[model samples]
Target: MTPARFAGVLSAAVTLGVAAACSDGGSPVDPGGCAADLTTGIAAYDLDGLDVHAVLPTSTSSCIVANADSHFVAVDPSAQPSGRLFVFLPGSAARARNYRKIAFAAARAGYPAIVLTYVNDLPVGVRCAFGTGDCYEEVRREIITGVDASSRLTVGPDDAIEGRLVHLLTAMESLDPGSGWSTFHDGASPRWDRISVAGHSQGGGHSLFLSRETTVFRATAYSSAGDLEPLSATPVPWLDGSWATPAERIGGFISEDDEVVSPSGAIAAWTRIGLDDFGGPVSVDDTAAPWAGARMLTTRAPPRNAGAVFTPHHGVTVVDGLTPLELDGAPTFGPVWAALSFPGS
Candidate 1:
């Protein structure tokens, strides 16, 4: 699809909003004091050197769907960017707005970041009856199906999601020269060579697919298991051991007590990719030769959210306002942040 058409579909599907809480004149460090006041028990990180900007759809597109509001650009205004792009994909039934804190933290740590939203197929107001019933399973199937559809539409030549994303990146690059999104590339195309992708839940599964299609320096999936082959073909590297890139660059984060995607799936993915189980919070197997970059992390403890007490451990990675219990000196979100900021860490 043409960029214009893709933008129209996205704009028609979702509304956009500036993240006022992160912007406005305030201390660049923790702009709205969001990081400092996180009740999720994850340690607060500083965003002192960065500026968060709301993106608007480019003027040419009739639909105002895929702009900075629905997406965000986090950059440091003080210095030249390293030309690296860190893209974060939100989970099923979740929007990019929910991950602003993580994006901001990435930018603070010096990685230009973008938070993306895809189709959410989960029915509204339906809660996963974790362990009590099969409601969660039904919802999960729908979510996986939705993810497959969205991926097929976006990643390939049809370009529903991927096209709109490139269009927005191009626009943002032009809107702010020498800073923000612009620092990553000229208006023509992104510095694809320096890109890394990360996602949570359904988005995590999508990230795995995207890494297979596009060569990224690093890819990380959180609270997600690989989809069934019939639903979405497993990435070639994961199955045939013929990685498109080094296996060391791919990682997975699984919450030990996750009630959403099976923890076994995450473990399986890690083991399939040649990582060994160290029986610890984090595991690494740099000696795996071709797959030297593979790593896996299990959440030190179960996750909790103030809003939903019963639904524990499902979305500990990207649930907005949810803090993770620190394990091995890092919170649930820590592994993801590290993957984006310091690839191979």
Candidate 2:
């Protein structure tokens, strides 16, 4: 997609007050790892054989406002002519940086990708401090009920989430110098072919939501159960009925022994996806190796819900139990990335 051709249609979209949706005047940080324009249409940047960049609604800013830095990452895979998109709400600067590496890998292997980084404000008092802690109901209630507080640190309304995402998309298509980083494929704004959404934990939930939106190609949900609290003996109502797409079309990656997210939940989610659910497990070995002093496991796909469960202690990879994939140097999950990298594979 050439910048000149994209500039034409993008010009009109920038007009109208829609371009001023950014809450803050701040610009998104490229971080040197990923490349792309943050405001208009998708800007394809070639890096290490990967086509990488950020895509968003034309008008944008850096803050977590209604339409601040909601961006997407686009990567072209070497193995294939097309690419994949990873969509999520940006949690922090660190995670965004790491995501660039993952995108590079996908692109190097002949797969282009996209990551959605939109702003979302968690309710105040909603402590996500402990890994063993569960706050499913509290969080769910918070979502449906807007937070009311004197200090002004409360949750927003129903459209609060999707509304903001749409604003970001609008800003991307708009033609505004201030809101300047939205991008799309084929140089046309908002091209939604072969894209996928992904996130970790809460972000994963957002990915699933976007999948149903039908604005992208497909969705990839990782390590996120809509209900975070540990389920009681009685079956709790899940959003199984409201899946954005058919269960089989959604890709889920979870650890079998994940304490944060129960394996039972993963299985249930898979069942919801039905027989057509894509990808398989890549088990990581938990047994200790003689020389390495740690057990090694392998994953056929990417592994989520492993950080807190397996590496709870931090800086060390454990191998006591095994999942489909193991995390060692340069983590690789053929199964998880399989669907995202190669949708029909």
Best-fitting candidate, scored by TM-score: 1
TM accuracy, model 2: 0.53
Q: State the C-alpha lDDT per candidate.
A: 0.49, 0.40
Compute the lDDT of residue 216 as modeled in candidate 2.
55
Write down the RMSD of all candidates, one decimal each: 12.8, 10.1
Candidate 1 global CA lDDT score: 0.49
lDDT of 2 by residue, 1-345 (tens): 458735653554434333223331222221111122343444545555443445443333322333334254444433554434334443222134335544554444444443454334552124433322334333433432233312323344312343334344444444322222343333212344454555655555555545544455655555544443343412134444454455545655555545445545654544553523332333433322221211112222323454544432111111212223335544444333544434444
- Regions of candidate 2 where Cα sits further than 4 Å from its true position: 1-46, 51-74, 77-84, 88-94, 106-112, 120-194, 210-216, 231-236, 242-244, 257-259, 272-331, 340-345
The sequence of per-residue lDDT tens digits that candidate 1 reaches over residues 83-187 is 567788777567777777677656655567787544444421133322222333333333322222221122121122443355456544434345455444433
Candidate 1 clashing pairs, residues 3+ apart or interchain: 11-65, 40-323, 55-68, 248-293, 248-294
